[model samples]
Target: MPAKKNTADKKISKTVKKDIPQLYSPLLKTYFSDLTSANMIYTKIVRSPITKGRIKSLTLEDIPEGYFLFTAADFGEENYVETLDIQTEILASSEIYYKGQPIALLAGPVFTDLLDLEKNIKMEFEKDPASKIKEKEYPYAQRFIRNGKAQKPEEFTKLFSKKNYDIKGTWTSVLNAPSCNEANGAFCTFDKNILTISTPTQWPKHLQENIKRIFNLKTEEVFIRKTISSGPHTNTIWQNTVIAVMASLVAIKTGKTAQLVLSREEHFEYLIKKSPISIKIRSAVKKDGIIEAVQVLIELDSGYHNPFAAEILDRLVIAANNIYSVRNIEIIAKAYESYTPPVSFNIECIDSQAFFAIENQMQKICNVTGFLPDELRMKNFERKFSLPFTFTNEKVREAFSAIEKMYDVNRKFISYRMESKNRKIDIKNLHNFPLRGIGVACGFNGIGYFGSNIFACNQKMEATLESDGTLEIHALQPSASTLEVWKNTAAQILEIDPKQIKLNSIFDINEDLSVPENVYANVSVMTYLLKKCCQDIQSKRFRKPLPITSTKGFTSAQKKVWNKEKFSGSPFFLSSFGAVVLELEINPYTYKIYIKNVKAVLNAGKIGIPKIAENSVKLSIQHALTELVVDENLHCDQISVSFVQSDNDPTQIDGLISRILPAAFTSALSQATGHEINTIPVKPQHFFKEMISNENSVYSK
Candidate 1:
């Protein structure tokens, strides 16, 4: 780690991601398990059992001499952590919003004693039943329109009603259930007003800021040490703070170093999960296959409230009606509080369910218009995006063309359509023939934050070319692999050894190293910054003696100019386009869906490392397939990924496969089962509930 500063002066490097290997064979240290302190006491968080209620009283009994207990009553409301505004409570005060919400922290040298104390604690609650809970709809983040002049969603729908065909649908996207990974833990010692906190988290900078505010310490006083992260994009922003604060408080109160880690169960229960959204779309299309107007109602189960509700809703509208010519589109979305744990709309939140809904709707359109799925997509594909984006029409077109030529998606889709049209099932002879479906969906994910974000980002990144030709980048830690890409970017441009570029990730514990929730955003931003810095240094290398410096900064204001409601941006950065054709055969008897083949084509600018890019797409395919169906996971051998050569810098293409695969998977399912499939994660139960629900079914006919 180099010295601290994320600022890049005048010199940055050109962007290039080289194939790099990780430097590690050493024993990895667990964040908490490896932490050793003679007097450290283990801590556990006791939570609320009821979903919605007021905590009338909480009593702690037999808290022995060395044991400690802390609750919200012991702290001020101002001393809390949040995603942006206030969401998760450090400890519940009066009203409990969800089940398994933390209510108190119990700590002791003997872990078993803490557990015993928790068991002995008596609690009383005044519960509120389901009727009292309000889960209602609210306004959408923005009413976005692409490819045509903007008009009111309602008025456009009314005007188009005369000459248009209407397609309406409602689908639910459930939580992408996560397996528990031990639990979140922290070790803190308060000494000399400098609090040292060790924990595993993606957002260390945010954690430092939170601890500083809570303990009334300065920026440098609250320090964060690099502990092994549980995994990328798994740790919630608030959980780390909550756990750290509890540990820090124990240290302060006990006058000794404190250690607190949630059990596997506690960690799973307390941490925020991805938001589950339900989307309803109503579209009016012309007979010529032109989509005139669309009205969408999205209900998102955001646990309590979504601080990024507007952003999530806005992105949904763009994805649902993007890359096409839709005259007018309106989305009305709401974030409702539920009995479940809190959720997040973080960078990694792909909203596959929403994407699935839109593309599924497109395949359904193909059914009515006598056009194939890709035909309907091409009929509306934009020549050049009217909205401000980085990718070009040529690059987008090449990807589409390659996918069409390579797989002959149209021929296969048509051939499958012809073969599987109106097949009556013979229960006695179900083994004679198999059911297969072909699906295709196009996807484009824009990199970086939207104009209006949940928090005001005022992050500054600095890079200095030391007199010794040492390229030192000052910022928080990104993933090890991504950092290598950044180094290679700088090394290629600076004509310096890649090893000469060192990252000083610990300038302040709270620097946003970027969780790489969307590695494309981080890769693009840092690579661009490094490019500018290196180019500046090259101009001064001969003139100046040594140690040239470059600094770059970003403000929330830089992105605020994007008006998603109107589908416009001052300059939306980079975008990657992808087209996926998934062919699957579903078993009529067992309803098992098996992947026949998945072929994808993408244009993500340039590839510094083709194998890495290809692997990313494959992993995404596996993840999407794992989510789309519960049975017969597809092997990587069955998936083929090819890229379109682009002259521009490498942009993001990591999430393309997962983003659009759900839609295509379901589209294929729709064909195989001879049913109009709208919802994702098609499970075994769906066959019995919907397909076999009627006697006049494809399986029963």
Candidate 2:
């Protein structure tokens, strides 16, 4: 096959500008310029100073009798939110689980009136020492194991004992800072039973359900419209949903439009921040660097109740083995209830621990056996594609090969080590305050819910024939995915030019269409699935078999089958793989790290939109970088929780570098660094410091 021409080398024609409006100005403005109202005011509970306490007596004075107020009591007995049958109570009822738990919510007419009401409210509590889940006393939850028809609390000490090798180290990364924005009040109004609520929410469907249940209204009675979200990564999930529900409750009860806009301080305090996880790993490895057995214990200081703690822990265990052939792996993950708010940090925290353990262990085995890291990894790497496996061996090999070729990883490794040795001997200058050192790390995370999880969307695309023969594509969100699926599908069906098709705005909620928890993994796969379905429907409709405008639901039973031991192989229909090689220059004296450059490659099947796919990979890198470098921490009751601080801002859409098209297979970081990294947001400063402090570090071993 001939070499593909670079996108930059392609010649541009004047007709290209006239043909591609979507490539330029794609955002279509609507009548609703602004969704927020000025009348509503919002404030969160100024939590009690104590951690563990029971509400004894509560009193409120000098407030109008009819002013809207709500607490956990308002949810009633029937209202509940369930993910994979695990029900998570939205509001804290009688007893507060953590110090910053949402006890009650207040919303009303004037901002001053709400503040005055808050000052008058008083509560008395009885301290309970037994209720607190202290870190020092009880670090983990009681574990039960089924042994020959008997269930017993498993001993943690024995389960996690090191048999052949052991390593102890602490890994840390800075949470990217968050940007500050003017506080805007969220308002909802019920006009003729059409309840329209606007807020910054990522999971629109979940928020809609919670609000419907709170107001005791049918699904059609409520409408959730999302505002232009500021943060796309982790900011818009659980916390925002809860606030929107509270505000809607106030509006519905008073028979008038109610608004709840929180101040920036209140947003910071009440909102749940990411939990910092501390991990300890022990492993059994052979002389050849192949892992035999592994034991890991992860401690999550979940501020309050964590809904995704169990799932996150499970993923960490699965990821601990890395992309190696291993047997007899044992993982024990625990979530400790703390006085701080519930923690939902990025997936990188777990990746950091797992990668640190695996990569370090690999290096150790190589050093002991006098083998290169790459050779050891390749020897143990899985090389076959089969079912009933989480990841195919072929896919892994392809990714590694692609990355190695793109970056010339083997040469870089030799160069980096030689440079480090030379720097150590010829350091005479006092002006260079900080010594520069480079480190590398790698990470992988699943996007959608795993196993038997289901997500559905009621997507509708309409097309009208025009006399001028030019097609106009109207879609909910215009991009390559929507264009190919909706407009192109319509064009093919009607036997008209794809440019002549028009798409209408998306505005429908089908109760049948739902997404299971952990929808991120499904983003890329679902796009393809939806597009395929559209093509199938278009082809069938063009044959005069039936109308394409019909509702559809998709469910996969693969995860359940695999979990039950009835099947082996991938539980998902498709999987996306990405690898990154970061060259980090760390200032040893100041503990500061500079990312010299990053080379990343991703494989996600056939590229639908080359530009969009490349952008996604770049965005992922930026997201990981911020989480590793930016510092955002919350200190409460001596324990600290972190947030995505403002400095870790997302990569601007305008300043994107080159978007590389995927080859037959994606590349691996080893090709660039000569060392395999298996962690997310790999902090060079932390890794280098640990390497320097511990002479028996993985790099030296």
Query: Each prediction's TM-score against the native?
Result: 0.87, 0.70
lDDT of each: 0.66, 0.46
Top lDDT prediction, candidate number? 1
List model 1 lDDT by residue over 1-701, tens digit each.
Answer: 01111111221122222322211111125656568788787878788889888988887655567777777755666546766555556787888877777887777888887777788888888998743235454432334333345554455647456567888877666535454454677888766555677777556555766776766666556566646655343345546766888888777666667888776665555564565577888878788887777777777655555455566665665566556656565666566666667565444444555777788788888877778776677777663334333224355666777888888788878877765664534434445577778998877766655544533233446788997779898765666666877888788888999989998754423344433222322666666666777788888888988888877755446565665445465334567778888888867777767789999988888787788778878887887676665554545458899988877877767667767887887888888777776665566676656656653454454
lDDT per residue as tens, model 2, 96-137: 566655556665556577667767767677887744456655
Q: How many residue pairs clash in model 1?
A: 31
Reference-based lDDT, residue 240, model 2: 67
Model 1, position 163: C-alpha lDDT score: 68
Winning model by TM-score: 1
**Per-candidate clashes, comma-separated:** 31, 36
- Indicate the TM-score of model 1: 0.87
lDDT of 1 at 522: 64
